[model samples]
Target: METQRNTQSETKKSPQTQPHQENLKGTFAAVIIVGLIILLSWFGIFGLFLERA
Candidate 1:
């Protein structure tokens, strides 16, 4: 019974790493969004592929 309790406690402690994974996923999404905004702004300013008169 004591060993069972110890195993359960150890298993519970290992789950703390899950939040770090979630944080990385969120940060990655933020980076992609910012990058797309910058790219679209560049295209808008330069007017790439516009019809040349």
Candidate 2:
């Protein structure tokens, strides 16, 4: 009975972290997308100028 109560308490602590982990994933993806857009624009502008030159 004592061990069972302890196990239940540990499981309850774990779910509190699930929402924070999901927010981190969302933020990470947003940063990646913005970085890709910046990189693509940099290359695109330079590519056209180089071809014309």
Candidate 3:
């Protein structure tokens, strides 16, 4: 039981020992693209409403 606990603790600590180096360039670009799409769709709907009114 003690050895099992030690191995479990080691595994838990192993992940934390590594520095977080995540590449988020694609994520940032995707977010920007989604935001722009939402904004453009909103403006387009507003334009249609104004034209019909």
Candidate 4:
């Protein structure tokens, strides 16, 4: 009976951990998108400068 009660509380802990994982996933995706935009803009500007030269 005691073991069953302990297992129930352990199962409840999973919900608390899940939100942090979701937030980290969202943050990682945002960083990747922003980095790509900056890189693309840098390349575009460089291309225009090269064309003029």
* Number of the top lDDT candidate: 3
- Assess candidate 4 and give its TM-score to the true structure: 0.57
Q: In candidate 4, what are the lDDT values of residues 1-53, reduced to their tens digit?
A: 99999999898785444434344788889999999999999999999999999
Off by over 4 Å in 1: 1-22, 48-53
CA shift at 6, candidate 1, in angstroms?
33
Q: What pairs collide in candidate 3?
A: none
Question: Ten-residue segment with the worst summed lDDT in candidate 1?
Answer: 14-23
| Candidate 1: residue 39 lDDT (0-100) | 94
What is candidate 2's lDDT per residue for 1-53, written digit by digit as tens? Answer: 99999998888784444444344788889999999999999999999999999
Model 1 gets an lDDT of 0.80
Whose TM-score is greatest here? 3
Q: What tens digits encode model 1's per-residue C-alpha lDDT throughout 1-53?
A: 99999998888784444443344788889999999999999888678546342
Which residue runs does candidate 4 get wrong by more than 4 Å? 1-22
Scored against the true structure, residue 46 in model 1 reaches a CA lDDT of: 70
Residue by residue across 1-53, what tens digits does model 3's lDDT show? 99999998888784446678999999999999999999999999999999999
- In model 4, the number of clashes is 0
Candidate 2 ranges with C-alpha deviation above 4 Å: 1-22
Residue 42, model 3: lDDT of 100
Indicate the worst ten consecutive residues by lDDT in candidate 4: 14-23
Q: Report the CA-based lDDT of candidate 3 relative to the real structure.
A: 0.94
